[model samples]
Target: MITLDSASNNNTAMEELEELFIEELMDLLNGIPELTVIFSADESAAELKEYAEALQSDPVGKSRQIVAACRASGQRRADVKQIIVDGNRKFLWQPGGTLRVVQLLRDCETRWSSTYLMSDRLLELYPAVQCFLNHPQQTQIAHLLFTTPQYQLLHDIQTILAVPHAAQELLSAEKTPTLSAALPAFEILLESWIDLQTKLPMLSHYIGVGIVKIQEYAAKGRKTRAYALAMSIVILCGVTFIS
Candidate 1:
């Protein structure tokens, strides 16, 4: 079985490979009747990445605005970084305290997780950000400052994306990784989004989009015999161990 990311080029390549496998390789593989080639996508990682990009690309999205404002100018970036450094010094001066200062992260288009990391860091240094924005010399960019409600929205975004992020990490683990974890991860993602929809009504649109994407991938995964067989093996192992 071959697993590929959900890229247009990868999709095209998979299709071509499938056609080749059926037309030319099938006859050759006929001697090995039990052997089969299965092509699977990196389910959770792709879905979560796409979901993050969607949030950032939405024209009306506050996430997009916040990111844009932060990245608007090099000077502004430097200022924010300086503020964080200064804040770290003060924090470390306190008795029995250690500095945990992190530079503000900028998101990259190629890696979706960067968006989450960026938001996480921005929220972490929010006080420094406010101080920078409210500075007398920084008045020109003062309009870029996020409101309390906007910051809260960003917090909500962080909370909502954490579920899928953890699932992606689990599926992509380097140690004793199993594809058998895929279905459970997807189910957890779907349930998490569904629950978030009710709890964060203001974010229903984003949550709805996430739910649909999860369902689509889950359905495609369920249709594959390998998925079912893997899940069955896990269940049987559990039952045997219990017995």
Candidate 2:
């Protein structure tokens, strides 16, 4: 075992000896990439490439902005929350209405899963929200509510992100896992994405770009694995011959 703590080595002779070992170890690993580099390569190769920038990206951010602007921007005096509550309450009490009232869920910056929940809730409450904004009492928030195109954008985003959000939740469990679990999960995701290509053209384009980058990294991983297997076989053969 080696100790690198400066305070633990008070002896002058030992300090000089430790410096020599440190220098030799550094020279020995001079060409090796750091852990951060290896981790980044793995991220770029895996499904992580799909959501690496999701926190700051437009789909999640823009959806949040649209909802927030309803209460804070444009005419600015409307109690958007009260309007939604009243509208949903009215709808729930209406004849032939059996569904429970659902409130809009805001996305929290620290919780990534909230983005998907927010979009899903917005879509579910769309009709009620539209009704509230259109009513005479909701003058201020009407213009602030998302326009037709903006709502469409949010819907598409929510639909596409559902897959990743579900996968994230499934993967985040604390249970012990194996490498074999990843391929099936990724295959399912890829198949679902391929089916959504026509339904979500914009999302398809973004996914296509990420797929290209991931493919390049995956090719590199394959070559590395092949080389390692070959080296292992050669080493085993030599060891057997020596024995």
Candidate 3:
């Protein structure tokens, strides 16, 4: 019924109003301390305030609330529209399309968490270990040695500690007895891993934490490859540092 793309006189006017409303909603959504402004064809201040407050409790809850309220308030379907995003919720909507009704919501802001990021980063470092260790002479592993300044020392410590855990993983996976990570013979040079850890803020603390985590996770999973991989990284780091 509502065609914003129409070339007709009345249709053009309605389309302009809809465009204005949509732009306003986008502005309110993007603003810091996020603003919730509701618009309606009737231009009822009380209704707008009520809708705003309802959204504040659960921004996307407007689906059920707005639909039910509109019915009671004698508001038509075309009278209202809202664009609600949970901080980072992504979607694309166009004017005069199917009604977007919110059923449930969660504030989708990604927490800048040190622990989660550190763990994820360590996992990312896993694949490179084998490459560096296998061909220490040919590979350039200096970049892989240190953590960025963004991390705490705890992250670094975890990285250093991950080697032993990775080693343990291999030992557990092997149908036959395998090498131990802590054994003096097996403790390959960890210069690169140490270098990476030192780049982080709280180097010593994060390294301590990382070591403990590697110990924990390495206990269950296949670790032979993990051990060999870790050993390779340690050795490569050491070799790269020497040169």
lDDT of 3 at 7: 31
**Model 1 deviation from native, Cα RMSD in Å:** 16.3
Q: TM-score each candidate.
A: 0.59, 0.52, 0.21
- Candidate No. with top lDDT: 1
Global lDDT of each model?
0.59, 0.50, 0.34
Runs in model 2 with CA error above 4 Å? 1-62, 69-99, 176-180, 213-243
Summarize candidate 3's per-residue lDDT along 1-243 as a digit string, tens digits. Answer: 111111333322222322333344344444532233333334454343433333233312222232233233223222222222211134332232232342222111232122223344333332232222234452333233322221222233345434544443444454432432333312332343445556642233434343444445444323457666666776765632232
User: Deviation in angstroms for 38 in model 3?
Assistant: 50
Cα lDDT tens digits, model 1, 1-243, are: 112232233323222322332334234334444432321244543443333343333312444455566567887777777776777777732443423455566655555455666677777666777777789986876776765544665677678767866776677677533567787778877788888889986456656766776788878998999877876787777732221
Better of 1 and 2 by lDDT: 1
Where model 3 places Cα greater than 4 Å from the true spot, the runs are 1-161, 179-186, 189-193, 205-243
Tens-digit lDDT track of model 2 for 203-228 = 56555543454345444545676545
What are the per-model C-alpha RMSD values against the true structure? 16.3, 18.9, 26.6
